[model samples]
Target: MRPFSLRVFVPSGDPTGVLIATRDDGIGKATIFSRSLLGEVKGRKEWNLPGIYLLVGPSKLYIGEGDPVGKRLEDHAAKKAFWERALYFTAETRLNKAHIQHLESKLVKLAQEAGVVPLDNGNTPQAPALGEEEYAFVENVLADLLLMLPLLGYPQFEASEVAAASSDEEVDAPHAAATGKRRAAYSAMPRGLLFHSTSKDARATIETVDGGVLLKAGSIVASEPAPSFDVWMPKYAQMRRQLIESGVIDAQDGRLVVKQDQFFSSASGAATVVRGVSSNADGWIGADGQNLGDLLRQWKQKNFC
Candidate 1:
């Protein structure tokens, strides 16, 4: 992946409030805000521009396009109780209604295909006809939007399992020896270094995201939480129960199989959920047999230093 610089502006001066993110030489900017801060960001001039928006919740997502985005956002705020945060991408007045519609269609379709987050959108509209240069403009804008998702701690749109399976290192190389039982590591974006964690009967794959680690779907996790886990990490234990009950991890068959990619606030949290025990993610191994924590430290030193 090519290196790019991102600049994030906190308009309200609160780190958790409205954030405006953009990349140098990029086509568009992403404005993010929580539902409570809607009124504060609503009056901004950019909200009146043509754009595509994402409404995010704990386990669901909604994608839409707005000629002037704020009207749709206000409608959602009044009716959609699921979304807690919202983000919109726009390139000032460069995008038209058809462009935003096409972008929204692509996002909704991909999110549904990922099968990670259940989407509130039921149907996808067809992308409008565009000339060669127009098509390029929309696709370029789409790429920029995707790259910005990780900045807000959203990685649901990028499927790690799919990327790992299709990656050149894991599939194209015939003689490369895999280090772990599942020595498959692939990065679909920046900060997405992969790891594979295992127990006697269960094996799972995961990768680091911006704010957390994401456990991939189809991973075999322990069906029961360990007794010590309940005593030590009670919040994670509760999260496990919630995931099981919400059908995120299917447990009805006596075996725990994840149906969709799952995100946890921390690597250890993801490790504990997958292994059903008290665990540290630092020990998890990548495809190269390097410790997850060590690889990350190296990455930080290389990037941040």
Candidate 2:
């Protein structure tokens, strides 16, 4: 068996929900799940996580004004109701007025900065009636948790080794077919990567194949290819142009345009859009040392020029 390791980093002091795992020998890869930034999990810590959070920020606040924003807003309200009790039970009761009030102040600051009007003073802040301020603060806390996850681990999380599956079956399947004794090597596959354009004009699509990796438009940027996963690169002018024209992608949002692939919808069956830098360590093409724009320019010179 290949050497395997499983380690996770949850920032020392931050409360963001982040899951970082590294697998196999040192050669194995590392993956990070930004619970807050990815919006994959509601709370970064089982207890200290906030209830309602707003995605509004200078970043491409994946949640927008029209249908997208409206839908997410509705879900946030429903989540407050459905998970209210459970979330409270899991909260870090250790939080005192000082802590809670500090968070509250931060929420107010963020809201005002973002131009969000505060809810009426009469509204309750917790479950059954969580105030807008409380909700927005939770989101801020979530983002903080995500930022801290990478710092949590000493070296990073690790993953266990997984054996590669064998294709040969029954020994003589192919030979049997030739001799009329058995069937031929049959490997049904799923097609994937149908629509990989960063351009919003290009509708993200995926054809079923034996092995499928759906890369859709507006998908979140990540090192690995998976559901709600994507990489944002405004450097791709073609992609940026399409997204800007499509009215779905926003350039000033500090996020690259990436649509979702229907094949890999959220557990809620909704399309997910995350904003962040690549967390795949070495998996990212030009992450640490090189600038993406420089690389793109080189690519254009070689291929287009």
Candidate 3:
């Protein structure tokens, strides 16, 4: 991977709230915010520009394009409860309606091919006709978007190798954001930490990400929980039940398979879900061969020091 820098700016002085991701080249920018913060970002000039958007939640994903994305987001906000995060892309250059339509179409196709999440859109629309030059330009915008999105805690549409990429957005106009290194090392290990979990009946892989830990797609999960699993991790116990009910985890041939990447608040929780029993450090092996508890301790020490 070529070396690049990504910036994430949090408005409202809250990193967990509305934020923006952008690159130094000023080619494009992304605005990310929860559904609750939609009103806060509705006033930005970029919202009125031609752009493509993805509305994502725990259960479904919707991809669309609008000449001015703000209106569509507002419409979805009123009609859709499944999406918690609304992320959209608009370029610094003049992108017309056709450009965004092409982006929307391509994004829909890719997400469908990925087959990781159920879609809210009933049908994918055909891309608008574009000249060779316009197509090339829009593709560049899409490439930048795919690279930066995963770092903002969204890895849904991207491929495994590309999902490891990071972004460029600002939560507020005329404000700057934090920078991240896009290097070979980052590609090799997307978030700098990896963990493996295995048991007699299941095996899985996980990585520490910006907000939490990610259980990789295609990981084998235990088909059944331990007798005392609820007592061990009450929160994840309920979550696991919901996941199964929602078809996020499907049972096939006595194995429970995760269909897409899932993020957890901690490594312990992810490990518990994977192995179907109480787990912490002992349940997962970290990149350096240290248990999660040991790795967590070292991280705490290093940061505090």
| Total clashing pairs for each candidate | 0, 36, 9
Highest lDDT model number: 1
The candidate with the higher lDDT, 1 or 2, is: 1
Model 3 C-alpha lDDT versus the unseen true structure: 0.71
Q: After the best TM-score superposition of candidate 2, give how far the Cα of residue 54 lies from its true spot, in angstroms.
A: 18
lDDT minimum window of 10 residues, candidate 3: 164-173
Q: Which pairs of residues have clashing backbones in candidate 3?
A: 20-169, 20-170, 21-168, 21-169, 22-168, 22-169, 23-168, 148-166, 148-167
* For every candidate, C-alpha RMSD to the true structure in Å: 15.6, 20.6, 16.5
Q: Please, what is the whole-model Cα lDDT of each candidate in the order they appear?
A: 0.72, 0.29, 0.71
Top candidate, metric TM-score: 1
lDDT of 2 by residue, 1-305 (tens): 22334455454334444443333222112223332333433333432322222332222121111121223334544543311211111123433333344333433333333333332223223222334454444434433432332344311111132112112222112353332311111112223313221222222322222322233445433221211111112122223233445644543345444543333211101112222211111111222454222332343355444
Model 2: CA > 4 A from native: 1-93, 96-118, 121-189, 193-212, 216-253, 257-270, 273-305
Candidates, ranked, lDDT:
1, 3, 2
> What is the TM-score (0 to 1) of candidate 3?
0.52
User: How displaced is residue 137 in candidate 3, in Å?
Assistant: 0.9
Q: Which candidate do you rate higher for lDDT, 1 or 3?
A: 1
User: In model 3, which runs have C-alpha deviations exceeding 4 angstroms?
Assistant: 160-305
Candidate 3: RMSD to truth: 16.5
> What tens digits encode model 1's per-residue C-alpha lDDT throughout 1-305?
35888899998788998999989879788899999999998889988999899999998899998989989999999999999998998888689998998888777766765577888897777778776567667766776677778777777676444311211121122353531211222232356677887787678888677545688898888865543343335556667777886889886367889899997645556777787665665647887897665554454456445
For candidate 2, give the lDDT of residue 116: 31
